[model samples]
Target: MTELLGIPPQLLFGQLLLGLINGSFYAVLSLGLAVIFGMLNVINFAHGALYMTGAFVAWLLLSYLGIPYWAALVLAPLVVGLLGILLERTMLSRLYKLDHLYGLLLTFGLALIIEGLFRNAYGVSGQPYPIPSWLQGGFNLGFMFLPVYRGWVVLASIVICFGTWFLIERTRLGSYLRAAVENPQLVRAFGINVPLMMTLTYGGAVALAGFAGVLAAPIYQVNPLMGQQMIIVVFAIVVIGGLGSIMGSIVTGLGVGVIEGLAKTFYPEGSATVVFVLMAIVLLLRPHGLFGRTRT
Candidate 1:
């Protein structure tokens, strides 16, 4: 077998592909986190739970409503996102002027409650989500086989990430959002609905998490703890990429995924700790993150 750097191409490329797929998830999830924290200054510990909710919602829609994967893809996010808007309107909105710690605590408690409820009902076991009929196949790449679904994840991640970046950084609404973040009063003086925008911003951010959850349903077992496991790594990605940086989250996510994937092949034992280790190093070296802007 042909080898690159003394490793078989199959092993190397296979992990790379897997890494990229994971990166897509990271990008999608972290984008939401970045937006929420950056815009609202609230630490949403419930983000992972929202992501888990998205997966379960998709599963429910399919199982109960006979909704197909494609339809569920659109509906799950919309459903969860609506709930998130409600959450913001009723609960989260009250805490904007208070300390970030309060928001974190509230969300942390919410996460525990949400996860506990699901566990109580569904038990701890993982449920399988079948691949969509159209996405069930593989591509023969000669060096390594590529799953059609996995490839779709990569493409979807890129489009979604880029779209998010454009929405936040380039578009007119994004400008208002950024402006609102910097000076909500000023934006409000301009006749823009800052409060409503904040509410919608949070909803949109949560929707992003739901979208990622649907994408991941077929790949991993749908379980309550899935978000519990992923949330820590994602937080690390957010910190490593720098808070309030959209592109940073996207790029850093993909980079972390590839690095972790390669680490699995090269150093199986350290693969688990590599991201945290990198986090520590980045924290020591660049406190603001690689692409993060320093808070004034």
Candidate 2:
């Protein structure tokens, strides 16, 4: 009954929570996009398709193989990651020296093919994915009744996001990864298999997308078209945060989600367009993005 800013606490927190959940998906998805672009200089337009494949893989695992959510969480990403590696080796490798647009177009075409195949096999209708039994309940946090699964999404997202940042920024392997991106010949001279590293990097980046898809399976219906809906917004988030900036993607994702949630609370009509509007403003003032580094 009590109101904050003339809105019920339930309504406010509910939308805020919803926003954060969506943001979790954005963080993970955008992180994958950033990693791929940062290290490989490839704009993976099929990322959405890859994400969709992840959810489908999880659903198939459960429906046919009797695999549970916990296993699917790990298995789905691995399955898709291997697939990604195959794509990189067989197809993407050919375009490394070509214009970035060539790679984008190739992946975009691949996205269309993948989406069409899934759409034909599984109609447009959404299939429900039940939440795991252990994570079914809610916790009453004084003002809000936070669902266990939703809270898990937020926590897992934060840990994964920060953990990824640490991995790429702090670890020796990460240093090698960065070095290879900066100077592949130099890295190769140091006895690193640069090409192999690139293949693995792409696979790993795509695995992040697949992992996010698995995280989203229960919250959103497992559907063929689900990725298409989220990918554009996610691309926007990646650009706004800064291209190729790992920390920027994570922090901006969480922050933008909260901002969007607040806008939804205060001005519901503008929630959908708010992010783009911010994108325009940020671009006008900062061409490299809020977190992107400017090259000399």
Candidate 3:
């Protein structure tokens, strides 16, 4: 058996693949959180719930409405994004002028409510989501077998991540988003609808989470609790990357995933805690994350 630093390549490469897959989900989900935090100054603790909703919606569409995976990928996010818009308009918007903690608390409560409702309806067991026929096999990659769906995941995530970064970092709409985030009154003077923009930003962020959920549905069992653990790890990734830094979040997410994968290969016992350890080190070293800038 071929080995990498005395560890078998099969084991190392396989773990790396798993890590990259997890990182993709983290990148997508954290991107949403970063966008919302940048624009609305809300931490959006309900993000995981929104993610769960996306997966559940996909599952529902497939099981009940006979929607195919391709269609669910698009429709589920729209449904969940509309739900996010409704939540923002009804509750979150009212709290915008209050303490930021209030927004966090409100969303945290919303998360509980959403999770509870799903648990009540579905119980805790995971529901299987079928892999589309097109991506149902693995390819021999010399070092290890690579699942086609997993490769698709990594490629798709890279495209989406860069696309989002480009929109936020390069475009005029992105300029409006940043301007409104920093100074809504000033932006409004230019006839921009800051509130509407905020609403759409929140919806867009939520939709990103939904998009990730759809991507993940095939690989993991679709369950109410799926997003709970993931969101926590993503929070750590966000902190390590620095809040509101899009590229930082993406890099940190993938880097941590790879580190975690390597740890699992060398010391399985410590794999679970490696991310938190890295997070602490980043906090102590930088105080504001690896790429976070001080907000004025």
Please write out the lDDT profile of model 1 over residues 1-296, one tens digit for every residue: 33546788889899888888988899899989999999999889999999999999999888888898999889999988998999999999999999999999999998999899999989889888899989989999898999999999899989999998998889999999999988888999999999999999999999999999999999999999999999999999999999878998999999999999999888889988888998999999999887898876
Q: Can you list the residue pairs that collide in candidate 3?
A: none
Query: Candidate 1, after superposition: displacement of residue 122 in Å?
Result: 0.7
Q: Write candidate 3's Cα lDDT for 30-62 as tens digits.
A: 888888887888989999989988889999999
lDDT of 2 by residue, 1-296 (tens): 33636888988898999999988888998999999989998989999999999999999999999999999999999999999999999999999989899999999999999899999999999988999999999999888899999999999888989999999999999999999988899999989999999999999999988888888999999888999998888899889988998988998888789888988999999999888998899899988888899743
Kindly give the number of clashing pairs for every candidate. 0, 0, 0
Model 3: ten consecutive residues of lowest lDDT: 1-10
Pairs that collide, model 2 = none
Q: Tell how far residue 162 is off in model 3, in angstroms.
A: 1.1
Best by lDDT: 1
Q: Which 10 residues in a row give candidate 1 its minimum summed lDDT? A: 1-10
Model 3 lDDT, residue 290, Cα? 95
RMSD of 1: 1.3
